[model samples]
Target: MCGIIGIVSHSAVNQELYDGLTVLQHRGQDAAGIVTSDGRHLCLRRKNGLVKEAFRTSSHMRKLKGKMGIGHVRYPTAGSSSQAEAQPFYVNSPYGISLAHNGNLTNSSSLQRELFEQDRRQINTESDSEVLLNIFAQELHHQNSYRVTPDDIFKAVAGVHKRCKGAYAVVAMITRDGIVGFRDPHGIRPLIYGARKTEGGIDYMLASESTSLVTQGYEVVRDIMPGEAIYITHDGEVHTKQCAENPTYNTCLFEYVYFARPDSVIDNVFVHKARMRMGHKLAEKVQNEWKDHDIDVVIPIPDTSRTSALEMAMTLGVSYREGFIKNRYIGRTFIMPGQKQRKKSVRQKLNPIDLEFKGKNVMLVDDSIVRGTTSKEIVQMVRDSGAKKVYFASASPPVRYPNIYGIDMPAANELIAHDRTEGEIAELMGVDRLIYQDLNDLKDSITEGNNELVEFDCSVFNGEYITGENKAYFDELQQKRADSSKKKKNKRAAVDMCNSQ
Candidate 1:
């Protein structure tokens, strides 16, 4: 998944966009980009790397002078890790639009062909996001309006909703008109817009998470509804419209389980509260199944799992301890593009504390076990830390399928739980016992707080594509990932040989 932000303020928003990207940096680590529009000109700066590294120099900051802007932090799920694929992709013909997108489009291959042949547009990168931007641009071009209005923008978004069949939450800026934001019909990705009162008028911001707006002192108006489009004019006027035919609320379940910050609220559900509920639900399962278990201390796997682990420990009546110390310098291993990178970073990401594990039965809690690489490493670390016995608990259910809606686990074989039984996975990870949260319980945890959210995009757990059955898409995705993996391996071998010489 990626993080996207848009702002229409009274003053230059380059600094605020940069600051906002840093806050949402956890969502993506591979690349960061920002585009600002001063009504007359659009200044853009984007590169492969973290937000700070991309915009480190004052010169880079100085060039981005505008009252309205859009920013993106991206980790590739659709494209290769190259500077050419960096976001805020621009198309000059369609009113000079620059767009940033979160989530993946399943119908991108067909759309790519359609764009090149039918729509007469060229796609420069493998990124589906660029395809999405072009689709929007083409739709806008179809509007044929010299002066694009909010209604025209909404119509363009409706066309986008009709053709694009997957998950997408977009923020696009028209050079002189306005900044536009829209979500896919199923609302599989998060998007929220808020405003703050200022002397010049109301300054508005649209972002992937509420934390970005709240942290910047903007009062949350509400989440942009499923299939809704919001337009904030350069002069600070706001307009919104429902752009989909039959929109459904199917926010990605993984966001609540792992991606989102605890402080943020999406679809009226507090992330921290939902995670606490996940802990309580998992605790109930543990109590019923393993009443005689010897889980002396509950230790979280650092960061995201801490909230759930704390609540689980209290419910299980076990001592809660910080068994692992995390190095703040490392990015999230799960979001790392390659298996080698993820494997190498796991140990660097966290170090086991001998005092917490020494002579104790330690129960380790993690958000979820995806590839099992990190889980295996952490279990080994705990063993090396003198633990008597090691038990593992996942706050979420097993990820048995690929997440086509923007998570990087596209191949079934890459998922530890895809074809393996819980017992088998437990043995493979070297854990004495493994307890996974049930799918029903996971749904309950998020919906308990907000009954309005009845549906979720849990494709990773159930293999149920929300848009429709995309067997062909899945087949193509698997093949692409396999080819990419092979290419990376061969490239690494060539690099090793060169270094030896």
Candidate 2:
């Protein structure tokens, strides 16, 4: 998934967009871009680097002067990480629209063919985001009206929801009109909107997380309702309508387990609290599974697992230690786009505190293990740190299937737990024992009492894709990504080896 933000303000919004994107950088970091409209020209800048790196200079920021703007931070789930694939993809139609999207479109491949054959539109990049932008543009163009109204925007989004068959949270700028945002029919991704009245007037903004709003000095209005479309006018008036008919809502479960920042609140639940509940639920199994083994301390894998480790320590009656020192500059290895990058970043991202592991029966907690590449590396690293015995635990269950909604996971065979039992996986990782959260426990932890959210997209573990798309297509998609991941990994390895020399 990616991070998207859009703002409609009376003053220049370049700095605000930059700050919002900085807060969302943890959501994605392979590349970043921002496109702005001064009610006339759409000044755009996108590059294959972090948001700060791309817009680091004063002159670069100066170029993005606009009262309305949209920004994106990207980590490739469908396309490879490249300059052309970075988001805020622009196309000159429907009043010079530029769009940034957060979720994957499962039907994009077939839709691309239809766009070329029927719509006669050429898609340049492999990015599914561009496909989504074109779809909205084509639908808006279908109305064949010179002046577009808020109703036109709603109708266009309705058309998009009717045609598209995957998860998406989109923010689009219609040049002179205002900013419009919508979620897919399934509401598989997240989008939140907020506003603040400055000296000039009310400034309206939308982002992937509520923390962006809080950090940028705005009060959250509420989550943009599932299957809803919002339009912010030039005069700062906000209008919303439910465009999709009878849509099902399922927020991605991984957001609570791993993706979103601890401070962010999504779907009316605090992410940090969900993770703590995850730790508590996981402890139920850990308590009985490891009751016989003498455990000395609970060491979190740093960052994502910190909250869970504390809760798990409290439950298991063990001491909690920040046993791993993480390198802050390195981006999240899990979203690094390729397996090799993730593997290389393990050592580069974290180091063991010798005292915590030296001759101790240490239990390491991680958010989740996807391909097991990093888990293996961390296990080896913990062993190298002189641990008497190492036990492994996952806050979430084993990720056995693919997440077609918006996560990047390798092919079925590439997954470490694809066909292997927990005991087998434990042996493979060289750990004394491995404890995984139960599937039912996972659901209970996220939605035990939360009434606002009814269900979650747990397709990664259950293999029950909510959209009911063909399983064969997902397999092909996974294989293609797996191959690309391997190639990028080998390239990184070669570069690292050369540098060592």
Candidate 3:
């Protein structure tokens, strides 16, 4: 959904925050922001752009002066893409808290009502992050403490767990003392905390993925457990509390298959290794289902599927080649807001190496097929490149339902596999054959070696919402997304019309 990083260090942490955001840029592309506590006042900088663009000038970086800070890279899963919705959402009350959150909150409507009518707080933006910040600020306000204690932080976080329903991993700057991080009761999102000793003292970082911690030269302590709250004091003391009385660990399985970086590890499971296992398991399916068909060359769709493609090629005794060269300038097509933009991005994002496809039966591997737009375009590209046939392979099972939890697939009809059989999907994509990994194999690949985490939130593929099913709520969300998309389109159209004048 999004990427977040928080740090409590003895030194000015602008460079570290900037670099961490850059590394986690893949998780979000719409906007980036950083909020720092100067001990006296909270310094905030946010904009609707990539991380580097957001901090293009040294002036932008220098404005945020603090030893403790938190940053966010956003991909609008809960709100429309705009400067106003970009996070490190600041609420000027109860220690001047600024919050950045990843994943969506399913009970945001109810929470908003409670904030308005009961708590008498007003939310400024469309972001659920702001709602969360207000709720947290309200809880801390009720505590009525002169100064914040770890116990106070625990109480506020426990209150949040009780009130909010959905996946969230939050990092907030408390303005007076330090930073706070917490995960949802179901642990539907990812959060990890790590620390390392500097010459002055210990530096701590909490991030959506462990890669940020490793990149920032901090050794991972461990994942912040399900429903756990952590506070890193100004003097580098770390305090933790198990806020949720009974927490279930159901992490998002899609992270292993597609979302996370290959180098990052979440819930103690290596994402790259899990994808490789997925490839191995898919190879077993291929051997059983398509042993008669000959795949002359295995070409990965590029980027996320590289590990799985390599392992599948090795197991199937097929040659693996890098067929598509993705342009670094383009963002992920799947996350692009509009269908037209997504289609256009697919054309610009990747270029096929004709040599790999010429006069060969090419099997294309991707992590999954959501709407089938990218898959269809890639299949066409491969066919045009002189490939005799294009076979499609998916690392995970078909996404057959709407993912109301955090993923952007909110409309059921928008899903290509929603009501389509395997044969129908293959026909729709115009591929020679489609091979999908089994749902059971998908679960095993992520959990086979990891002992700390057991299950995953597979709502998109399985149609089972761990948080609870609210069809009316999800339908409302879908309508909101559609309305936002139409507004964006209409605004663009009006600008074009005026320009023509």
How much is 224 displaced in model 1, in angstroms? 0.5
Whole-model lDDT for model 3 versus the true structure? 0.88
lDDT per model vs. reference = 0.90, 0.86, 0.88
Output the TM-score of candidate 2: 0.95
Q: List runs of model 1 lying over 4 Å from the truth.
A: 337-340, 483-501
Residues 208-244, candidate 1: write the lDDT tens digits.
9999999898999999999999999998888999999
Q: Which RMSD values do the candidates have, in order?
A: 2.9, 3.4, 2.6
lDDT of 2 by residue, 1-501 (tens): 889999999899999999999999988887899999988888999876789888989999999978999999987775665577778998887678899999989899989999999999999987889899999999999988897888889999999988888789999998888999999877789999999989998999999999999998999998887799999987797889999998777888898888899999887788888889889987778777656668899999988988888898899888898888888988766555556778888889888889889999998999999878889999999899999999988998888987777777667777888988999899998999888988778777778647667777988888888888896787668766776664775465456446644
Cα TM-score of candidate 3: 0.96
* Model 3 stretches astray by more than 4 angstroms: 483-501
By lDDT, the candidates rank as 1, 3, 2
**Candidate 3: clashing pairs of residues:** none
Error of 2 at 372 (Å): 0.9
